[model samples]
Target: MSRTIMLIPIGSGVGVTSVSLGMVRAMERHGVVVNFFKPIAQPKSGDTGPERSTTIIRNATNILPPEPFTMQYAENLISSNQTSDLLEEVVARFKTGTSEADVVVVEGLVPTIKHPFANELNYQIAKAIGAEMVFVTHPSNDSSQQLKERIEIAVSAFGGHKNTRIIGCIINKVGAPLDDQDRTRPDLTEMFEMPSSKTNTNLEVLQMFGKSPLRILGCIPWNPSLVAPRARDLAEHLDAIIINKGDMDTRRLQSVTFCARSIPNMVEHFKPGSMLVTSGDRSDVIVSACLASMNGVKIGCLLLTGNYRPEPQVMRLCERAMETTGLPIMMISTNTWQTSVRLQSFNMEIPTDDAERIELVQDYVAGHVDKHWIETLTQGSTLPRKLSPPAFRYHLTELARAVNRRIVLPEGDEPRTVKAASLCVQRGIATPILLGNPDKIQLVAEQQGVKLTEGVVIIDPVTVREKYVAPMVELRKGKGLTEVVAREQLQDNVVLGTMMLAQDEVDGLVSGAVHTTANTIRPPLQLIKTAPGANLVSSIFFMLLPDQVLVYGDCAINPDPNAEQLADIAIQSADSAAAFGIEPKVAMISYSTGSSGSGSDVEKVREATKIAQERRPDLIIDGPLQYDAAIMENVAKSKAPDSPVAGKATVFIFPDLNTGNTTYKAVQRSAELISIGPMLQGMRKPVNDLSRGALVDDIVYTIALTAIQASQQQ
Candidate 1:
């Protein structure tokens, strides 16, 4: 179960990243599993400096989420009229990234520069991911009156839809002074709107509503030093090396003070926590700055320009003062004007390696932000979110790691298979036994630069012929097998691997890398046979679509199934889904929806659904529904409103292989979805097959599934 909270800015520079990450830190401190994601990261010139906030939080947090795709692909999809597909992929990734978390912090984009397409991206993302949103507005941008108008306009624009839930709003970067008078004082509304107004009567008034209005959650006061960049950060970004690293680790460069003014005039302008930039030959000005530093004033860092250092005597004096003052000195080749221009575009980030900054951010947010409101939002018995691709992959890995079963592969010399085995062993997901010549396998691995980790065993299939020949003949003598024929069959690694699984030598077997599904599963069918009370083996694909990981059954096997075979396939597929932690909602899919388009195919599906229900009475099974009705709520409401599994079916059972195979492939290619299967079910022991064009990750997950299946069977 998960609750997603999306943070959006009224405009750019509205503190979206700070609040999003801060909440993750706060929620996590209370032992809550908090996950963070930035789904639509826009890349420019192949640089990702803009996404440093996400990098910082992920580095400092416990969540290891998936990386975001560049917005270039999303733009292409939008221009090509594939917005639905893009939205699906986004939701799918969101589901995967946050599936295991109690709360998910979805950080969204506010256009850094003015743009045309920035209007509803956040709203669309919120709706697609089923998340409630909280808006953050910068109070320093405008006065109390102007800020109120902007807030009203932004709320009207962003929360127009009836379903849009604006949980609260945060007034950040408030300009009010902290317990100090005699400054330019903006009213309390400018700082943050209270529940009822008690300050300046000239300011705008606010009225809170019961359910739809924006509630006040946080009022963050203006803090210049808290948002400042470190001296070393500027040095690295500017390609300038530090001459002295004294206290560079702790000092923050808040504002830039140009020493273009005279020494007498700039003395008044030289404030604490501000970088001082000037020409290198200005020894007179440097002496005054050192005197000020020696007088117990904090200066951030000193930058000398034009690639020059001070004279020997001046340098000695400056070094002596730096030792006592803890000041960092930097020299840059660029002149003062050029340096100022370069610093104009420099973006500051919370350093990924700075534990002190991380703690400060967390502590600051916890102190000012409303923990009471966040507790009310996150503390409850929330319903389970639909299983997403990221979540499924993470859970699959964890389950495989926990079970740690032994799964063997016959085609170990195959590159993808070898790589997958190496990954499984390295990740502690499984122990793999490769059926091939160990020397040749190692040779191929070295040629491919694939290092095989420990817990992987390589066996020569030819050497195992003597040991398996008697058992092969004993198991297959009914088909007129002899010792000669048995040895010949054992020459094939898949046949020998099947023999290993049949004798319980290995927990599971996965093959079909260089062979057809028939060549791979034929040995298993003949040797291992079906499980207890099972009629025949069928195949299922774990279709990892955008929003959810769906189970599609009999997509690779059974050319045409009768009612009984179809029911058996559904039952097995449901069991597989449940084994992988999905609560099964089975849908018998056909060309019809609840007898609306009756035909032979539809009738067959109806009968199969009935049979499946009788076999497993507790299963949430519905039938005679089309694909849309099975998965879409609106279509189900129109077509099969009373069916339990109509709109939210997690397992779909197709009527025949012709329709199922075509549909799964079409969805996979057209939507850029991932399919991890054609996994053969109903074997006495676990044996799975792979597609010829399977990726390395496909093989890895298939092996993980095999390991988990082995554990379940045991």
Candidate 2:
């Protein structure tokens, strides 16, 4: 699809240049052609050229041969005062460049408060270029909420009526110590799970922001190489010994100097991966080694690191190296030690395990990148066809363990259950079986907005009375209930549907709109009797927000479950996490960390932690932790120093529903994060519950997630 991404840099003192370069590097890794543009740059007096960020972008993407048009600077075309024209110029340039390149990344100027033009600029540029916004936020404890507020304000102030889609947020320069913490912060990235955050790479940060079809891109680390420094500092940081010295030479090697005194000596130590530098004073030796290393030995980098004039012989050698190895001899203007120090202080954390990053980025590009936009821009060309289904499904059996996947509707005299059921089947998300009259089901779907699809199997309760009677009798065979009594229970009607799931006739049942939670799950519990070892079937609310996603467990089912039940809830929640492509890191949430506080509430969680571990020995489980200690690494590290689950817990098992629901809702309301479930788990088949107030899109996503869960169980 369309590859153009509008990279809007926000906040003051944020490293926008570092982010831009990182994006280019990441795109290069994917073998995608990238063109860079700066829509606006606040010029400084005595800075007679383009912004420094532009220079960094050029250096990062210099692999592509320089084209006259590709290197165009917007100094004369746009100015800080001309905010309106700036938008037009940026869009025109971006559109023009997109035609030649696979993707174009546009970086906005620094944000402003007094004049407050950056928001307007961002909106105008995004709208004009049809570019999605990848807002960059400097990582902070309150970064998530701050970003949400800033975005809301910007959208309100400058977003206008235009549908400017925000792909995701990138927490830039997420500081080294907290990198791991940020990487696993469910509360932070949960809001944008579809587009997960990239960790510790600026290129990744930029690519995440620049690529269309928005997914949570990974977090980026600060790159040391890009930080300006002297030549000598570079050598020391790289652990290289300096060989040459000169004024002009020092300037050339100012960035990344690998110093050596003599060309011949430096050449001998030039391991294939080693960085080699020769002074112009030693051109003869430089020429000789350049000729020698031309065959199979690939030198990492060659630097002419001194001010002394280079002899013709060295020039010939450099030409030979260029022709044979295609490696540029970078010229720097500083001594080795100075360069080494500069590079040393600027450390960028590069994620070695990036398979997940690639997968997530691809998912975003596949799902959100506008195919139509791409086709129009690329002469009717589109991205290759995707192989996977657009939606996913889950089994009802899986939903029973964690939460009740009930499709609730307004109580009505007419049968609307069938229409809801039909909606489930037609969408290929849920398996729906009619609980009422088959004939009436058809009439109701026609009357309502829904149309029943062939996928739906209508089971007439009256017509199939005998069919379910035997199963009901068998389920209560040992419970001392007679066939007549079992049949009478089925007469409640919804109980028969629940019996279908218990009898393994269907995966699960959904009938809560007309019935209370007690009525909805009572028959299943009485009949199905909590899968094999399950103590109780608890519930977890998957709060899906635009900013993050969270799991609030035991919220809807257990009001104040005892220690034994809480333990079961913990295990079930962790299992549910696994079913949804998330590896469980269970957190037994309490008001106390360790034994800091004493109370019945804390005691229950502590006991539950013990029981949960005893039950699921292999799971990473820890508990009796405050909410902050459970989710925040710094807080967890301090509060529960020895607990493995502290600070990285993905599955939070609250002590009680009140605490669970209240905490989750507070986070949601404060952050405006979307909450998805009470996703039911622990059933024998794929059955889910929907809130009566659920939106169509909410239903669609939940269904997809449920289907995925079901497929995994299979």
- Number of clashing pairs, model 1? 3
Supply candidate 1's per-residue lDDT for 613: 95
RMSD of each: 19.7, 28.9
**lDDT score of model 2?**
0.54
* Residue pairs of candidate 1 with colliding backbone atoms: 92-546, 96-390, 96-391
Q: Which lDDT tens digits does candidate 1 get at residues 593-695?
A: 8867877888889999999999999888989889999999999999998999988999999999999999899989998778999888898899999999998
What would the TM-score be for candidate 2 when compared with the true structure? 0.46
TM-scores of all candidate predictions against the true structure: 0.54, 0.46
- Please identify model 2 stretches exceeding 4 Å from their true place: 1-427, 614-617, 641-643, 665-672, 685-689, 695-714
Q: Per-residue alpha-carbon lDDT of model 2 for 414-462, expressed as tens digits? A: 3445444555554445554556666666655543335677766666677
